[model samples]
Target: MFFLKIRSIGCAILLSICGQSAWAFHKDVYEPRVPNEILAQEQQVKSPHPVTPERIEAGRRVYFGVGFCVTCHSKDGTGVNLPGHPPRDFTDAKWQKLRTDGELMWVLKNGSPGTGMPIRVGTDITEEDGWNVIQFIRTFGGK
Candidate 1:
């Protein structure tokens, strides 16, 4: 009878601890921690979807095939780790919110210099293909 009571008490304590932890934690969505004053100074811009079905498809093929986007961007374009650069969470709307279309276009066209991402397939890739790939990238959203 004493053993049963001890076991019951232990189980209740475990459940309580688990319950507290579950409630306290949440997956942090990607939002740039920019100051409100800076945000106020910045201009708002929208990224127009410049991709067509055919181009987007071609880009997808390139991304999954020769472009080797899967290595860094992951198979789903989630932006996995390589070395120096922290992978961009494509699903993060907050991260996406910070970049303009032009900025993203430029990054796609000329890969970031300091980061592990280098100019590779994009040099040969047409502008239309880049746009398509960017559009495809935009689709990954947090559920």
Candidate 2:
């Protein structure tokens, strides 16, 4: 009889801990909106630099090297789900289809605020390199 009571109490404690953690992950976090002007722009606006084999290769290097994209987005761009946040999967065909080159570049340059993505403007990647990275990410969905 005493063992049953102790077990019940332990179960209740475990349930409460799990419930708290679940709630934390679902909590609404405020993310700023991207400007409509930029979002509405055409493909040209997104990637001013022309895409070439060399550019894509350069971007690949950045992804694995300096950009450190593999750390979060993973080598295949399938992304890794952290404790409370899930990384964006670049390999999703539907998701990739909907996004424009400009949007991708914008995200790379400014980074997705309120998320794990950091602003690259002040980082080691230059504007040209950012464009190159965009070129590489486009290949994630297999054009």
Candidate 3:
């Protein structure tokens, strides 16, 4: 009886793992033009930010409140960690460098489809807010 119980438990665990859906490595799927936002594979779009202190501050407000970026990206934009998904390290200068303003805008508007990032569609969030968030993300380095 004990052996059977152990076997059944193991089978159940295996089934659950196999039955689960796959997690997206990249959050953006709406950027049809980019066609390469498969995070870790290759960047389809670019990141946008003016790298100014003022812009960063404004972005911080949107992120923490209106944008609700904190819920998943976390308070520091370091990204939230979970099973089957890797966390985004906002501090990575290399990653920041590769992103372009246009790409960032696309991500903001459409969001990464498969990832936890929300599309943020039809919201009052202005383009200025998006750019500001970029600035704030740059500050993630915390200089």
Please identify model 2 stretches exceeding 4 Å from their true place.
Answer: 1-38, 42-44
Q: Show the colliding residue pairs in model 2.
A: 46-102
Report the lDDT tens digits of candidate 3 across residue range 24-74.
Answer: 433332323244544433344343444667777788888898988887788
lDDT string, candidate 2, 1-143, tens digits? 99999999999889867765664565333222255565565444656678899999999999999988888989888887765456677887777777777777777778764456777745878888888988898898953
User: How would the candidate models be sorted by TM-score, starting from the highest?
Assistant: 2, 3, 1
Cα-based TM-score, every candidate? 0.57, 0.70, 0.61
TM-score between candidate 1 and the true structure: 0.57
Clashing residue pairs in all predictions, respectively, total: 0, 1, 7
Query: What Cα-based lDDT does every candidate model obtain?
Result: 0.60, 0.74, 0.64
- Which pairs of residues clash in candidate 3, taking residues 3 or more apart in a chain or in different chains? 27-112, 28-112, 36-44, 46-100, 46-103, 47-99, 47-100
Instruction: Show the lowest summed lDDT stretch of 10 residues, model 2.
Output: 26-35
Q: Candidate 3: worst 10 consecutive residues by lDDT?
A: 25-34
Candidate 2 vs 3: which has more lDDT: 2
